[model samples]
Target: MKINIPETDQERIVIVGGGFGGLTLARKLAKSNYQIVLIDRNNFHQFQPLFYQVAMAGLEPSSILFPLRKTFHRYDNVYIRVAEVTGIKLAEKRLETSLGICNFDHLIIATGADTNFFGNQQIADKAIPMKSVSEALFLRNTILNDYEIALSTTDFDDRQGYIDIVIVGGGPTGVEVAGALAEMRKNVLPKDYPELDCSEIDIYLVQSSPQLLKGMSEAASEKALEFLTELGVKVILNNRVVSYDGEFVEMKDGSRIQSRKVIWAAGITGSLIPGLPEGSVTYGNRLKVNRYNEVEGVDNVYALGDIAYMEEEEYPQGHPQVAQVAIQQAKQLADNFKKRAAGKEMKEFSYRDLGSMATIGRRLAVVDLPNWKFQGTFAWFVWLFVHLFAILGSRNKLVVFINWVWNYLFYDQSLRLIIRTGAPWKKMDDVIDEGERG
Candidate 1:
């Protein structure tokens, strides 16, 4: 099938993935001379930084997502297609997606990254990774469902399996999740499940590295560790989770932790598209790009965000796969497009380090700005302000702020509800088959 985008006299720019990079680029160039086609698996743009908050039941998933069509309703040149890009026809300058084939004058790949299990099929089979809104919601459901099951179980060992959680990875995601779960364990669980001892619900954060938040400053990492420890999180450093089979988490050192849920926030690899030329990809499945974000050995095709590996003077390996890097690169590429339109020379992309921050829990956080490094209450507020400001919609900002204030005052998260639904991979036909079999 062929994609049904209207033919235009202007050049077409097809962007894959509605992530920070693609979304920013499309928004910046919506009024430009080029016809923009934005394709993604989901019809909405997800705020990944706040995904943990959704998983922890602190915020709703809809609060962090904005509709793509709504974003470009006024722009006549923009078209949004909800489909997965299967492959690229580099020779034809076309894209083969699940929906149809699309032709583009220029293409931008910003497909972002997926949870990396590091070639562990067993772990991949059982462990849950919070990479998207659906995954986050599934995690929330699994946790609440486990608690429901635990409330009815009289056996101690089985109850331990139901309640205990093992989070693998000490990065910002793992730290934030651990902190949020720790908060739930302390304040929410005791009141909700009065029949069971909430203290038995151990929250273990296993990090292969020596410190939490590895890329952040030493002071921030140490402070995060301290805050998590103070909140009764069992922070295990320098320990790798080798395998998990729905019951126990086996470590690299042959140690085992019996837990039903394993949150795999360990690592990420680029979401690579097939049919790319040989030697175009590098380590971690990222596309090798130049300073102009143009993919090597490919013309009129560029890469941005977590999937692009652009080596600069300071970052010899590549820029860090963060949202800021993606946004900055997108802005630069958008400007380059405008420059090309104006018959002006395009400029090279440069990254500005904005530093990093992670919140351990309420009133406990650490921030490392370029000029300032701090920990504690002020840092926590700063973290909240930055994230709140970054959310897409004004309604989302108000809802999240109210949720935070309510949680703070009452020590409760009202969103802890188990929403049962078909898994993303399960088709309607599969559900019908299962129902018929039953």
Candidate 2:
């Protein structure tokens, strides 16, 4: 089926995925002469960095999401489609998606990444991943439901299982989650569930690496560990999860932790579509791209964000899979497209390291810059300010700021209402099936 895009003499630039990278590219190309078609599985662009905040009830899901249509309403050159790309037919210069096949002159794959289970299907099925708004809300519902179940259960051991939270992979997500849970245990749980013994609720953060926040400096890692420990979270490093059977997680050292809730933040791999050469994928299932973000061996086909592995002299292994890299690459690609349209030589892509920061909890965060390193309350303030400014919509920023201030003053999460009607997986499957049937 032919897509209902506007008939234009300008070249059609198709971008798959509306995450940080795709949205940035689209916005940058808004003023250009190229006709742009942006497709994504979801209608909203999720601010993934604050997903834990939503799960922890610190922020609402709406605060971390911006409607795709709303974002591009003022741009006449761009069109938006809410559909999942199924495959890419390189020979035909077409993409097969949920809506239908659409031809494009240039294709940009910004499909981003998904939670990595590291080849463990059992863990993948059972563990909760925080990658999207729906997933975060589902986690929030499950956490509340588990607490309710804990309160209802007469057996002490069963209650412990319900209340205990185990977060695997002490990266930013895991650390933030553990810290949030610790805060809940210390401040919120006591007030909310007064009958339940908050002390019995355990929060454990398991890291396979030697230290938490391995991407950051040693000082940052050390500070993060200290912050988590001070919040009453147990940090277990140099250990890997061997298996999880829904009730307990077994470690490689023949140890085990009993918990019903397991949040997996261990790793991520590119979420790729079919029809690309199978061998083109590298480590982490990322598509290997050239200096100009063009897919290797496929002209007019490019990739960016977590899905693209562009090796450079400074980053021989490929750049870090962060939102900043994706945004920068997208902007660069947009500029290149404009330059090519004007019959100018295209510029090579180079990432600018703008530093990294991770917040542990209220008044606790770490920031790493080229010449500066800091931690604690000031870092936390910087983290908040940067994130607030980074969010797409003004309404989102205001809502998030209000929520953060409310959470700080009251020590309570107002949006902790369990809205799940049935089993989470069953509901998700039903939705997918409905879409297929439609």
Candidate 3:
């Protein structure tokens, strides 16, 4: 297959993955004399930070995603393709994509990370990961379906399994999900399923580390722990989940949580395309890159976002795999491309620490900035504003803000409908197969 991209006089730039880095880089190079081609598994740019809300039924998935072709409607030189890059043929200056082979002058890889199960096959086969819109919807459907099953089932122990949830990893994702489910239990579940005993429906957040939000300051971590405790989330710290067999999760300390649903947000590894030299990959399967974001052992090829591992004096291993780093790297690369076009010296990339924040629940959050550290209702507002501002489109922002308003006033999330039709909850393998097909 030809891949269908037309030949152009301008130097072609092929970017894989339409996540934060690819999108920003494409937009920056829109007017430049480069024929930009962006490809991804999905034809949408998703606001991933707000995905927890989608999973928890506070917001819809469509509100957080923007169509890729629609995003480049104004750019004559930009072309968007909905296809996965299977592998890179660096020697031929080409990409092996699902559609066909695509040759490029300069190829930039922004393929983001995926959920890391840490070599646990049982967990990988069972645990539901929250990395994309589909995964988020799968989680939402799973949770809602579990409740429906619980309400109808007569077996006491089986019913409890349906309601109990164990969310692994105490990072922002785990904390946010823990808080969201806690909110649902406190405010929504009781009203929805009055017959079911909400007290027995336990929500546990298990973290291997001693503190929550490891990368953040001690104050912020303690504050998050406190907030989650206040929300009735059983915070299990300093323990690793040894195994999960779909029915129960066992910890290293010989304790077990009886749960059917397990959310895995523990860690992430680079979603690397095959065929790259093994030496180019470092810890976490991330592509080792120079300060210029150029992938090691490769020419005219660069990487960005969580996939690129560039070690600096400040960051000995690599920069933190966050959206901010991806965006900043994209901007820097864009500026470098422009500089090269103007026959100027291309500068190296450096990351600017803009701080981090995590929302526990309503009026509960923690924010740590270089100059300021705060927690509580104000921090929650700050978290909301920062995320709202980071959303792709103004219309999306409006929709999310309105959803927040409605949910806040009514203490309810309206997107609780489970329209999914598929195999039984016991057949998670079937569900995974179905998701892959979709």
lDDT of 1 by residue, 257-276 (tens): 99988999999999999989
Candidate 1 vs candidate 2, lDDT winner: 1
Show where candidate 2 strays beyond 4 Å.
421-438
Error of 1 at 409 (Å): 1.0
Please give me the total number of clashing residue pairs in predicted model 2: 0
TM-score of each: 0.96, 0.96, 0.96
Off by over 4 Å in 1: 423-438
Which prediction has the highest lDDT against the true structure?
1
Per-residue error (Å), model 1, residue 80: 0.6
Q: Give the TM-score of candidate 1.
A: 0.96
Tens digits of per-residue lDDT, candidate 2, 287-388, equal 999889999978799999999999999999999999999999999999999999899999999999999999998899999987899999999999999999
For residues 1-438, write the lDDT of model 3, one tens digit per residue. Answer: 869998979999999999999999999999899999999999899999989999999999999998888778888999988898998887899999999999999999999999999999999988899999998988998898789878988898899898999999999999999999999999999999998989888999999989999999999999999999988999999999999998899999999888988999999999999989999999999999999999999899999999999988999989999999999999999999999999999999989999999999999999999999999999999998999999988899999999999999999999998756454443645664444211
Clashes per prediction?
Answer: 0, 0, 0
